[model samples]
Target chain A: EAGVVQSPRYKIIEKKQPVAFWCNPISGHNTLYWYRQNLGQGPELLIRYENEEAVDDSQLPKDRFSAERLKGVDSTLKIQPAELGDSAVYLCASNERGRNGELFFGEGSRLTVL
Target chain B: AQSVTQPDIHITVSEGASLELRCNYSYGATPYLFWYVQSPGQGLQLLLKYFSGDTLVQGIKGFEAEFKRSQSSFNLRKPSVHWSDAAEYFCAAFNAGKSTFGDGTTLTVKP
Candidate 1:
């Protein structure tokens, strides 16, 4: 039983450059989530997808950040013209569709904007 | 809107000593609570969760949490702390469309 897998464990990009992170959720998991964790702070929900539809994305910065979970199995989060403040660990988690279940997380992609 | 609060920023405990971390949540209906732990530069791991049925829920690693509906609190405890337990813990709750998380508490275990 493999867990969620995220690519490019660490990334460094210029402030004005574009960056993207990818995640492959666990098999049979119907729910996917993207979270941003800042220094000394908890991971904040950025977006959620139940299959191909993005159920929630109010917290995602529409101006620069965009995410899509095509086919509902894998997801990619992109940040264009990245800002210094955007530097943080981006985590991807998966869970079975239900009332409430434990969310299994990947190692996460740590981004650093220089 | 649902939100979680962790009052403690950091706590240090000696090995084999009792440990407790506080968590408070705000929600409209019945609350669904969760505790997650993360090691250095790692992703968050589920420690435990409580939806209903029992006031006290036992989690992995000999950790347990008590949910007090009246006080809107769900504090985690371990009778005897271990060095491997040192990590950052987060409390979270799901709301209308998304989940909210606390800032987190960093635990340091003294050998």
Candidate 2:
């Protein structure tokens, strides 16, 4: 089975532009997560979804960030009027129900806000 | 809130030499620990995990980690490093269905 999949491995846009990232979790996985990794740092949780419901999203920057995991399979993360600080790698990960905290991650989308 | 810390930002070792990366965590509950490796332009890959039982757990790519509850640490080790082992390694602690990762240690294997 394929691992989690993410699109647009790399992206470049000017500050104040809108950007979106897409991800398709592994088949049959019930949990999905979005994380942001800055240069030289480990990934930080942005949001988490259990099926169609977003279980945890308190870490997400509501001012410009939004995310959805429709149908509990695929997910999308968007940033409107992106700022230079938003430039980072957006990672998507998934886990099977009842699994012991093992998360399969995608290659990640690297966004550069100029 | 639970958190993980990797004191070393980077490490260098000669190929075929033994290697170890330290990881420390702070959590209120029994910690589910993990080690992940990430190559350039690649996704995070699980090396090994420690949930319960034996303190020492072996993982993929000849990696192993020892969990010490007393120290609140789960340090990764390899008997002999290979050039391909050069990558960023992250130590994580899982809690409440979420995992917290450290800053990551970049390993460089010298020829």
Prediction 1 global C-alpha lDDT: 0.92
Local error of candidate 1 at residue A9 (angstroms): 0.6
**All models, DockQ values?**
0.72, 0.85
* Stretches of candidate 2 exceeding 4 Å from the true structure: none
Residues A1-114 of candidate 2 have per-residue lDDT tens digits of: 888999999999999999999999999999999999999999999998999899999999999999997788899999998999999999999998888679899999999999
Per-residue lDDT, model 2, residue A87, is 93
Which clashing pairs does model 2 show? none
Top DockQ prediction, candidate number: 2
Query: What DockQ does candidate 2 score?
Result: 0.85
- In candidate 2, position A94 carries an lDDT of 92
lDDT of 1 by residue, B1-111 (tens): 567899999999999999999999888885688999999978899999998898999999999999999999999999999899999999988656567899999999999
| Per-model TM against the reference | 0.97, 0.98
